[model samples]
Target: MKGLRKTITTAAIGVLAVNSLVMGGFVSGAEIVPGSLQVKEFRYLDKELDRISLEKTGEPDGTRDGHLSLLIDAGEGTEIKSIVLKTADRGGTDTGHGIWTTWKEPSDIGKYLLAVEHDGKTLNKTFKETLGSFKGVNQFDLYASDNNSMKDGEYYYLEITTSAGVIKSDVTPFADADTSYAPVLIREFSWTDLTQDKIGSAAFGEDGSTDGHFKLKLAFAQKTKVLSVILRPTDEDGKAVSAGIWRTNRAGVGWLLGLVQGNKIINTEFNKDVTAPVGNFRGSVTLDLYATNNGSIKNGQHYVIEVETQFGTVISQPVEFGNKESIHTDSTVFPFKTISLKLNAKEAAVDEKQVKLDVAPFSFEGRTMVPLRFVSEAFGAKVDWDKKASKVTIAKDGSKIELVINRKQAVVNGAAVQLDAPAITRNNVTLVPVRFVSESLQMKVFFDEGEIFITDAKEQ
Candidate 1:
């Protein structure tokens, strides 16, 4: 009454579309759409005025001029609390009033202001709908603490005026079959597609049959009551599995009598609808499972699917059918694998000191050679070249070595020595074999797996 402002508009869309919302700010875990009200359990109040269809009259533009009114009796300790505009049926989105609603509760003595949030700015626009006490959103916390709480068995009524505008659906109005009955729906929590989180292996068993189970990441938008999770096994081409093939249910026994949905590690059943103090819209729970489809599945059939529901499904694209391991992240796309190489302090020091060769090592005349200046300097050696003589000299620890390009011999410490591989230039790199000089300079070099490891054995 005080702050209530009416809205005038004309547009509406309709669908059983799937949607989800995240919960927050609740006494339990996360605040969900208030639901604990039983819509499906209405028993008609055994009277002519119990429950009635919402008469929706509209214009040519799908606009409608109608009103939804509810008469009820608040039992002992009960109150006419907050109201939620539902956007969908319990199954999925089918247009309901999904918006900011303002209303006043009527009493025999006087009418009192109760709730009003619908302005142009503050509408809960996620289009999420819930039907119950999802994440511990208390009933009392919804409305302002005032005349909102009604006395037990006292009757009160409220009304909403729908302007001539596009309209979809509203809450089904009902009179009291049971004056004490109340049930509310939390909003749509999530609509998950586990195609990417699909992971498992199918491989040849001792009997030459395939053995493995598929795993999926099942996350709900709300803590939902899971009714069914059906996986249909098919081939790479999505054809039915051939006969004579079977999969076991974990013990490699029982011929996998059935498909079970549960977190085996925690030994908790995932198929069962979760009650209070249990579910939330936080992280995920793994749904690991194996199915036989009444022993009709075969080894050739590897892929399976989660039957579609109000909450979507688990699915993926076809791949080369084989006995292999597969795992997906989210979205059921390709699995991105990550690798890490751990380098400790000592190894890190070597890495920091190792010269980054301008190019990879190459072989000439059966001897591996490296860039002279860079490789030599990496090991604390000084290298210089004489352009007039086409000669390269290396000096380290007072030992001097000299070599001429294309020559097969070298002078080390003023002593001439035979060279199996001569110094040469290829691709602008003056390459040389440091085997003889390095060993002589108290250094050890080893090559493996296409990499060179050098260790200085000299004492500083």
Candidate 2:
């Protein structure tokens, strides 16, 4: 049984209950570092290899043998140090009923318990050596009745530790033996000239109209191979206008999805029924088509999704395939922090040479990038700068900020700001006010004590 057991000793469990009662406990653990738990080791039980790949879909089959071994990283900062494996007693003689080896004990000699001490906490799971009562174990029942409810080949949970709390993901696995889907590439057909030359021949009454064209690129990860593709287009009402499956050329040129490879006109179901996501490009709209790749894609490969319309071809900005591991990272790097208010600078003043402001959380180059102005104004400071003289000033309730340009030197409320390009003015706008905006807003400005320090603080 692949399951979970909160490895806290009986005493530790009491402490958590007490803490919750006293603190009005609202705990979370998944927000620690990303990808904290890794699959350290896994093995297929050779004796029961057939059962490991059994298809329990549709109808239940008790003839399958289910047993496996997995070792995970279990140590400090890790939420679970062990897993409990519980199996039912099949042979009325009580031979098959026992615990699988856990982290606390080795499985080499038929010991039970998948995870154990040597870490901050432990979790336990069970595996069925042979199909028996059909009642398997799961994370919820790992400690109760010494069992869990789970089918063979199911993934249980991911545990992580955080300052505020711990988190877990209830994951499950599937077998490919039951059903398999062949991957297909989706591409829109249309024509385009990279040179931007005007085609004299017109297909419509509008300008830039040409004969049938196709967008060669398909929407899938770069690592995904185009085994086969189905091309379909629908009107605004989702009535299919054309549909065909094309085989891609080894070297991607135009698509070969119509009839024969550069030979015949492919048969199409123009009247087929379908639905598509709609997007507007100026006055015209296009249908958003989806295509499933024929194979599993690498987690982070960038791919291009292109569409061809009667007007012209519009390509989607490149996107990366989703990865289970990066979900938390993406949220953290793009979470909503503060709203940014872009304001035109008012004026320049004495000792008030720089200003700071807060910005809504934004991302650049996979990092959280904030606006300087929003960060500053949030601190109750009036920011102003001189584009010609390259001077910036911040006055909050008479607190002054004086800063120079292209140098790690400035005075904020009499304190110095060691920043490069102090309150830079660009396009008639100032960027990055004096670092003192951090202290002014009661924020913590952190860095290597080098050229510049990024700061964070709550708005007033």
Candidate 3:
């Protein structure tokens, strides 16, 4: 009760916590670990009624059909006995005698809001058995009936009886006066192929007979509305590939093709809204990706699943179809070159091969300066000096850079770009800022512990 307190407020939801009870329950050498128990309030609308009929409100009268959902993630070797919910007021009472023994069928549980699916099956577990049965994160819905509903402004707390002892949640209102339930999408996992053997991997066959499947495990907040889910082919950098790669002349290879729930496969047409179960939020769906004519996915192609929801877009990590060797030949593909330089060191390493520098790198005006010729040539750029103009030009991959001595401005491909420090002559060697030159050449630069690393590929 006397610990850290945190509060989270969103457009349609607000949660107040005490004693480190926001994401997890308060710890006093208890069985449950810290930051594992999450409780949220959601609008529990009647399944038979129109969703638009309910107005968002926080008044006591407005909470007639609201519910509280507790997401419990017990630590290893933990066992939960029962969970009790009661108002903070001293005279508050538990209409069900503070213990939930009766098991509500999955169908009955879906009547209220905050339903969820697990492994493509409707969540069917009693409050006492949710954590133990799931063996991981589990959601338990508390109905807003006369026996369990909380008043609008009343602060309520949960008493979870575990194998160790009784752990209590912080005292907080069930729902904020102004908060409503907003939909949220949390991606659990994504895999390619039918056996789910290739997680986040895709493969294509020559005849489309071995076409791959992209599957996703997505968890949503209560009342979340999805707009569209797209499986788009992309490059190694996760950028979408050229259009028409998704336009297929083959049948059954259409976009938004398959929805897998349990053992049932629901075939849906393209551009149609893929509705998640009414009250369930945690669900898994399978999408088919086949190679067809112009839309055929090439070898080494990467892809990402974009879930456009009412809230916003949720994109998964990039999944590659085949090995990079099958796409880019050794002659055409070049491995990223990493150039390492240390402060005041006369030696530098390009891909771990030492190269002698005419002048050691040093800091000037808080910027790391290196020999312009050596650094430019290290990245395969041509450097030329114009003695009359006191300027140096570096050309690489169609980009031209011109820098003048004692001038803070540099011209990059006909555009004037500002430099932090002007090129200076040190020990008869032209020194320039390493960051500006490397980044301008489309390379990434990182500095740490008196060392600088430059690479053509983005650093992880």
* TM-score on alpha carbons, each prediction: 0.24, 0.20, 0.31
Best by lDDT: 3
Best by TM-score: 3
Error of 1 at 161 (Å): 99
Give the Å error, residue 44, model 2.
47
Q: Which of candidates 1 and 2 reaches a greater lDDT? A: 1
- Per-residue lDDT of candidate 1, residues 1-460 (tens digit): 0000011110000000000011110112212123222111110011101001111101111111122222111211122233433322322333322232333233222322222211011122121121111111111111111121221222222122222111222223222222110000111111122222122222111322323345555543222223123343456654544333222212111233123346333222221211111122222455455432333433344554332111112233322223343332333221111111111111211322322344455665545565667556656789888989999898987978788999877787777765546788866668776444444454544332233334452110
Candidate order by decreasing lDDT: 3, 1, 2
RMSD of 2: 21.3
What is the per-residue lDDT of model 2 for residues 1-460, given as tens digits with 9 covering 90 to 100? Answer: 1111111111111111111121111222212345344332222221111111111111111112232323333223344433434432221112234433323322355443333211112223233221111111101112212122334433323333323234342222311122101011223323221222121111112234222222332322111112122333333232323232222211111222222223322222211211111211221122212222222222343333322211112222233334323110111121112122222322211111333432222222222223445556654567776767777776766667676655546675676544322344344444543223444444332211011222231110
Clash totals for all candidate models = 30, 62, 2
Compute the lDDT for candidate 1: 0.31
Candidate 3, 255-366: lDDT as tens digits: 2224445554332223221122212242333234332333345445676655443323345556665543222111112235667778999878876478888899998765
- For candidate 3, the per-residue lDDT at 407 reads 92
Q: Model 1, residue 407: displacement in angstroms?
A: 0.3
Q: Give the winner by lDDT: 2 or 3.
A: 3
Evaluated at residue 46, the lDDT of candidate 3 is 20
